[model samples]
Target: MENMPMPKTRKPNAQWDANATKIFNEICVEQVLANNKPQGCLNNKGYANLISQFNERTGRNYTRVQMKNRWDALKADFTTWKTLLLSASGLGIDPKTGTIAASDDWWEEKINVMPLCKKFRFAPLDNDEDVEIMFSGASYTNTNAVAPGAREGSAGNGNGNGNGNCNDKDNGSDDVQEVYPSPAEKQPVKRGAAYKSPKKGKKNFRDM
Candidate 1:
């Protein structure tokens, strides 16, 4: 009989706690906003930086595969959460808990169709903005990539985006609307009592 080849042992997955997950999400959000994401995915250099930042912040020695796994998981979570958000648009989010304001029955019904959504119902749904930026195609795709000439500027910022200075300037607003006093607040211009000006060549003499 032919000898059977032995199966390779599987590597254990690195489980991230809440703090680590939060840190990872925050790093991903920052990178996405910095335009490190192209076509809804991080470029090679961007991914490296993301890994470095995530490991630094969490003090964990996670491999690239682990980070990528978490990234994929987050993307899936965002998709599920978004669908839930649209379906339950009328439901309010609790300010204190950050969870959706829905009855148990509603969640039960939704979870049957979206089993992945079960985690969100019980867990505090935080980082709404970060997840939107990191996972949403619409958000990341809108950002323009670094122009050929703008590479130096991006390199200086080290975020791999176009014109690093422009991002902050954009957030500050380009077209600042000047606020003028209301008509009621305007003061009448002060002028000398309606005295006619002297003729062009003649000057008015003061009373002796």
Candidate 2:
């Protein structure tokens, strides 16, 4: 029997450390909220500028799609936090006394208390559901196989030629060409391999 394919994992970008989160938080607060706007609200130009600034400062590559997804996740977290705060106020407490206030000060205090980096960090995905959440529209394919739209015989070895095969006509060498595996290839585990739990850690994706 064939073994089931193992899930692929990626590491978090170190450049998108605490500093990047701080910058993002400040941008939203100063540029968007200071003018009496909602949290996590940004126009196209605003988002573009934010991405540019983040990449420029951190020297990291972040696509626009990633920034948008990250913003959505942050906004969702903010909304959930507010909802929980509102719900807590009604439990065994006087409404007028305000046991748990959800005010601007409260919001700012929450933001100040924790860095956005920690708040938005993603735990490593261990199941299909987690992968779906992290990569909603992405399709996983075997990197060892040619891509769907790739021209036949066009997958080349980084040598600039479309032909992966070494030919005496192309280069005056009758030696057999050495083929290398694509970096994205995943080696299959043997059947009945023991399952091991992944160590507790965070992973970064375009969304995070």
lDDT score, candidate 1, position 178: 21
Model 1 / residue 51 / CA error / Å: 1.7
Candidate 2 has which clashing residue pairs, if any? none
User: Which one wins on lDDT?
Assistant: 1
* Alpha-carbon lDDT of model 1: 0.56
Local lDDT at 10 for model 2: 49
Instruction: For candidate 2, write residues 112-200 as lDDT tens digits.
Output: 66443223112111132333222222222223222233221232232121221112121122222323335354232222222222334
Per-candidate TM equals: 0.58, 0.34
Clashing pairs in 1: none
